[model samples]
Target: MTEGFLSSEEYDEQAHRLYDVGDYDGALEMLKEGLALYPNAVELCVGLGYARLAREEFAWARRAFERAMVLDPAHEDAMVGMGEALLRLGHRIEALRLFHRVEQMGFDDDIELMLTMGRALYRDGLYTQARDVFGRAVAARPDSAEAVASLGYALHRLGDDVGSGRQVRRALRIDPDLHEARIYLGHLLYDRGDWEGSLREFERVPPVEHWDALAVWRILELKRALWHMESGDARLAPWEDRLRALEELDDPIDRLLAEIESEVAEKDGLALDPSQLELFSGRAEGGREHRVRSPDGHVYRGSWSAIVRQMRDAAGFGHEPLSAFMRRMAERWHEQSGVDVPFRDPEVFLRAAVEYRLMFLEDGPD
Candidate 1:
């Protein structure tokens, strides 16, 4: 049908489809056209609010939401949209009040609204509140894998690893094909020193489905350690390529910030323990048997166990057991990256090692 003939609801539907597929600009244009024809269309205003929110135009989003609310004060979606925009604008208390108002208006059991509000809270680092919101969503729809897994992630961020694991596993049982939750469970298992469990969860996710660099890195480390796969092994080619592709997609600014943070971490670590200066010193130089290069270009060659041994040996701490050295390095990595790296297994140790730029695999004679 011609644009002039299209009803406001039809325009809203088209815009919703575009928004879902990440076509924010198209959604905005369509909503603007619909609003021009149907100036009093509350749904069109709400759609515009969400589309603007998707593009992170928080002020514009709030204006659209406010328009929708003024046109229809009881509109549930407009209230939630306004709350989301407020949260993004750093008006936490105001956002919470708006969300509370929506809940009190009988949207307390709205599964989608609850999930949206929970995600907004989680993104703003309010994990405890996010967990409660997600819990409400789960309660509203007990079998919702998305709600359960979201709750699990919120719990994980709040440091309740055990509860997180339980909730994630429950979500997996509800929907095994939820790859995001599966990947999260894999990391949780790896953190708890369950190599076989972690590998099982990760392997279930096809390599093409693996989008996160951290997950792909863990897969590579697990394969090398568990199966004794060589760096040049054909089986590792897909995952290695995936890792490379993901790294290439990383924001240059983010990469620079991470490098700077790593440098700052090393310096702070050195201040805490003068002996760690050796680990950071000559970062881009050194190597031997089974040579491999860290992300920062530091080289270390040998068995995975020997790699940690070599790091300490170079620092004159060779007398320390390999496990102890690995644990110490893992602790330092956690301090820097806030990721718990399990060191009980050599390959797992290298997973976090490679991630935090402590060490990584390179082609060399085994």
Candidate 2:
């Protein structure tokens, strides 16, 4: 069929397929073409909004969402898109209000809507809120493996490791193909010192299916420790290649940030603890008065661990254990920048986090 003869719904569907494959540019072009032909098409506007969002163009996303909302005030997807855009734009309260509006408009039982809002909350580090929404999604669709897995993730972030494990296991039972949940379960087991069990989970996921560098790293570490595999072993080649590919896919800005942090650390004689090579860790502390500036320019002052705690509290993560909070931050850094932050050591973690733009070192309070 010719593109010129496609209906608005067909255009929206084509754009959605492109978006799902991470082709935001193509999705944007398709959406723009559709919008030009059918300016009043609410679905096309919502698709445009999501495509813009995937590109990190929050203001444009909001405008697209606003246009969709004006055309159909009760559009659920449009409201969710606007809420996400607002969250990215630092308008948390308004974003939340829009989510609530969706529920108030009688979409509370909508499993997809609930999951969408829950994931937005999860991405913003609002674990408590995400947990609640995911719970609702699970209730609405008891057989939905994705909803159950999402709830599991939220529970994990909230420091409920036992609950998280159970929910994630249940999700896997519902759909064994849920590799993301399986990978998460592996990390959770690794965190609990269950190396054999962790390796079992990691091995179930084929190296080709792994997207996150952390998982590939863990798989390699586990194989080395459990099987006594040498680094040059033929069995390890695919995983090593996968890790390299994942690392290479990191954002250029993040690479620049890592380079800058590396230079600063080298010049200042800061060295990462050799024991801190892995992702998870126990904890550490210091007594010196340390001050750090967050991305928003707010300064947190105290010892190294204390500064992280203060930042955690400010970010509404005080409810979780300090170690868990640090590990969460470190995991996020790895996922974003493909660089590991040493969660066991506060100083090292903070130093590494500068590359992820999570925090920066500042002079001690005078």
Model 1, 220-273: lDDT tens digits are 889999999999899999998987665455332334444754877777544435
Query: lDDT of each prediction vs. the true structure?
Result: 0.77, 0.79
Clashing pairs in 2: none
Per-residue lDDT of 270-309 in model 2, one digit per residue for the tens? 6656654332221222235666787766566654555665
Candidate 2 residue-wise lDDT at 302: 51
Name the lDDT of candidate 1: 0.77
Estimated TM-score per prediction?
0.69, 0.71
For every model in order, what is the number of clashing pairs? Answer: 0, 0
Candidate 2 has its poorest 10 consecutive residues by lDDT at 278-287
